[model samples]
Target chain A: MSGQTLYDKIWQSHLVSGDDEAALIYIDRHIIHEVTSAQAFEGIELAGRSIWRSDSILATPDHQVPTTEREKGKAGFVDKLALLQVTTLDDNCDKNNIVQFKLNDQRQGIVHVVGPEQGASLPGMTIVCGDSHSSTHGAFAALAQGIGTSEVEHVLASQCLQQQKCKNLRVLVNGCLPLGITAKDLILYIIGKLGTAGGTGYAIEYAGEAIENLSMEGRLTVCNMTIEAGARSGLIAYDQVTENYLHGRPYAPKGAMWDSAIQYWRTLVSDADAVFDKELIIDAKDILPQVTWGTKPDQVVAVTSQVPEISSAKDAVQQADWQKALSYMSLNSGTAISSLSLDQVFIGSCTNGRIEDIREVAKVVKGKKVASTIKRAMVVPGSGLVKQQAEAEGLDKIIMAAGLEWRFAGCSMCNAMNPDSLASGERCASTSNRNFEGRQGQGGRTHLVSPAMAAAAAIAGHFVDIRQVELAQLEGIH
Target chain B: MAAFVAHQGWVAPMDRSNVDTDAMMPKQYLKCIFKSGYGDWAFDDWRYLDAGDVDVDVSTRRKNPDFELNKTIYQGASILLSRENFGCGSSREHAVWGIRDMGFKVVIATSFADIFYNNCFNNGILALTLKPEQIERLFELSGDKAMSLTVNLQEKRVTLANGEFYSFELEENRRFKMLNGLDNVATTLLKKQAIQDFEKQHKQTHPYYFTPLR
Candidate 1:
């Protein structure tokens, strides 16, 4: 018999039943957030359908709630509304018996960040959320993706999900990354080359020498940006790195069951000689620390490269787009990227706001002070645990002493769901993905870069290459 | 509603790929919870340096503008032209809100990311796709003037008022929804009676008996 790819094996195993058009796939885990779940709960009430298998469903309030006000209990009715949404979810879960991590609960943060920390996100599980970046969970070697509010309602009513099988694409990144290039750079380079839509209609399996060498945190960063490239999910084949990350976690199996879990996880890798519908090969040597120059993630150039000239584009539409991007950014073509100044800097999100990202930024900003000209710079960790870890290492003090704001954990400024945002027309060097017009705030200009790059830019008050600063720290670290 | 076919004018230049929903409509205005009037705030930050404040005059902003939309090559565009894989991040319908609110009737690109494209069709926004060469030609002709691009929803054809035509593909369900302005929720609600009947029948057979888990 021919060997089956991990995608085929997991997908086939999850299939409850199927016909030609669609299949009912049993979902292993369901995560809910405030922004999309409110309406879903309303739909459930309207439909008068009680939630079945509430134990498998998990709820949290992340998107709309303010991370800063998290400590003050619930602030006012709006915050209370968000709290009420969580309460309603908890109440519904309580009435039907579903598990949730409330705001005051020990495990509370962004849904994606908290899911993994609590060991709720396991391999071979099919996870779904109402938010798009739920693809971030696929790093655990699961087939995870997002759904609409209506679909969320369906999943709540029935534990099963109706899904179409996705085509598998094996993206092979060979060779080792050059010094100073992280997984953020690798994925950014891929998105830039692929033009964002490169992975449509496919679930990408990141393989080869480079991916296997990546740490768990690094794999999460790559998987987080898969959606930015228009792929449903991106995953690495689990190995010793995966086992080590999950070994002591709360929800991971213990003792003899742990050995069995590892045995099953070891089998989660793509079978040798397994066929994939599509294949893409990228060389790690070719990638560099990247930054978004335009309104999109794919419209990026190397840190050393100049903003692309509109006149140089062969297509008139592309030329016009180039001109528009230049106009909005208030940047002229041929200007060196290093010459650009920044008003603000933000480093946090599901994308690069984990503990490792905080540590990396702290190493660069420790001895350095943020430039006086820069108006604001903040480092929001991905979760409470990440914040605690950074503080334990004195990384928070380093960030604060350098004159940057050390914020409470949440998806701050990544999306303007919270008070943290750029004033209109304010240009910022952000570690978060996407630089579309007004993404950070109305008329806010965003330049996407890695966390370390954002730290370097914050210190210089302009876009600067992190490699220019010699750091004895993070040299021998993974 | 009349299924009138409008003539396609010149194809304006395409925007960069992966323009997210948040960039289309900043989260500040999402507080309203209603979909209407969001068009004014569609690219509020990009349209003005401050929200609700347009520093440069509208005509001058349209003329001597530093804004992306006012650039000479893409002036007075009815149809927006873009590269492949447009609208990639965040499933916020605001991305479509911004696109439609900005007075763009149609968006032509090589491809569109799933959610944003669906949101566009659901809100009466047309996504016209074509080969790269054809899109390139539209941009060449649009050069710094007001050009008319006609979109015929019934025929599913995009025509430049000057007489170039292109055909694109869309799923049948999406086509029906776009033409009628029906979303999944609205469609589901249409089957309310059938759903109610099914529930009633199921309830009758199952019989309500509660046994608390110990």
Candidate 2:
């Protein structure tokens, strides 16, 4: 038999029983949030079943939690529908004996962001969540994926999930990244090349020189968008970078246990001769800051390129899709992306709302002012800890000084679960994932870009190549 | 849970490709804890000229006369004839809920996004895949007319109005679950003993992974 890929090693280790076609995989961590999980808890409760291992599950109310008016407590929710979902989750967590990070708690944040920061996600373990973005946890080399509500109920009742084994696909991004390119740009570029369905039916492992060089937070950004590429899970082999990031975190192992865990993690890599079902090689030097021109993540192009014309599409379907996307975005064909004006700027989501992302944006717009023509601009941290760390580093001050609204952490404006959404016919340069039509709000258009690029757009009142923007001199800043 | 052994409904053609869950049920509507009532807001942005709200009566709302679903011929259609990548983006089961509640029991497409397809099966909605050519043919056949199609899960076949039939495949376990109106938890319970044994061994070997309730 051939040597096994890292995905195979993790899958086999987590396999409880049955053949490769379908088996019960033990879940180490189960993360739940307000959006997709209410019905799951209700399902089990109605069936007279209880959470099998409440301790293994982490609950938080993100998605619909307002990013403003924190002092108002639960009553702070302006929408009745938002209040109901958030309160439902609270009731479920309390009744099930699961510890939850309440809205007022310091730990409360986006499920995907808080999981790793709290050390609940670790290498060689299996993780599942009701949210698709749970693939974010796979950055730690864990076997992670998103599940439907039915599967959520299954895991809550048994702490295990029945799943079919997926084929392995390895994406090796080699060479050094050029300046101004972020992991967000890299992922968007890859998804653009490999259509949204490219990673379907497979578990993709990102490897090579470029992936290895990424910081842990950058790795999280890459893995977080794996779902948009249509991958059930995306993984990076555990190494020093992974281990160092996990050390001493809240729920990470300690002392002898930590040593033992590291010892086991060392074995999590693929064997030298391991074979993948498919392998794709991407040159990092060829990549640039990317922006999605269409509703889907895969419909992306480098920031410097113009909107592609319908006649240039390879097929009839593509031509029609291009026309539709252009009509919805209200952009002219062949016009440079940099020429597109923006009405709003959003620099936060599970995709790019980590401390590093905020720091990068702050570095870009420190002494600058947001364009007077830009209607709205906001920077939301990923988690409460990230928010606090940004404040401690004075990143918030720099962002606020640039005239961008500094908001609390959540999945703000990413999918517009809160009040931070764009109005009808508005166009925005966002740091969030998924620029699907009306994703930010009804009839609102979105362009996906990096935090730095988004910040640059906020200042210019239009999309601009971040590399061309001169950083404000720190010495001149008050 | 309800069995979906066979469904016969008039077809409604959604000519667009990559009809994502967000478009099916916008993010704003996901706020409600209730699974029902999403039907009224399904495709709300495109369904109505005016912004839609739950409390507003859909009948009185300014329906988009140009939208496919509002067309006179497709008024009560139950099977959605769509293009490739139907139900892409997001793992929200609420999207499936809205589709089902909107009277669509079947979705015929060339392919489907992974999570959305699974959610369809769980919700008793048959998401059948056909070859691209066959899907194109179906779309051609659906043009300018409300065509009645039959999806028989028992036989794993989709019969066209002209007496043509195409076979589809589903996993045996999934098929069993659908036929018996069983949810995943109910089926997994049968393997409870094996799961319990595994957990016992796992907790001991990986004690740090488990955080028992205090």
Pull out the clashing pairs in model 2.
none
List runs of model 2 lying over 4 Å from the truth: A472-478
Q: Each model's interface RMSD (Å)?
A: 7.1, 1.6
User: Mind giving the per-residue lDDT tens digits that candidate 1 earns over A14-42?
Assistant: 66555413556656678886666665676
Prediction 1 global C-alpha lDDT: 0.72
Candidate 1 lDDT over residue span B51-143, tens digit each: 442122333333326665757656556678777767767776656766766677788887878666655665567786788788767666665
Tens-digit lDDT string for candidate 2 (A205-308): 99999999999999999999998888889999999999999999989998988987898888888888999998889999999889889888988988899998
Q: Which candidate leads the pack in TM-score?
A: 2
Worst 10 residues of 1 chain A by lDDT: A76-85
Q: TM-score, each model?
A: 0.80, 0.98
What's the lDDT for candidate 2?
0.88
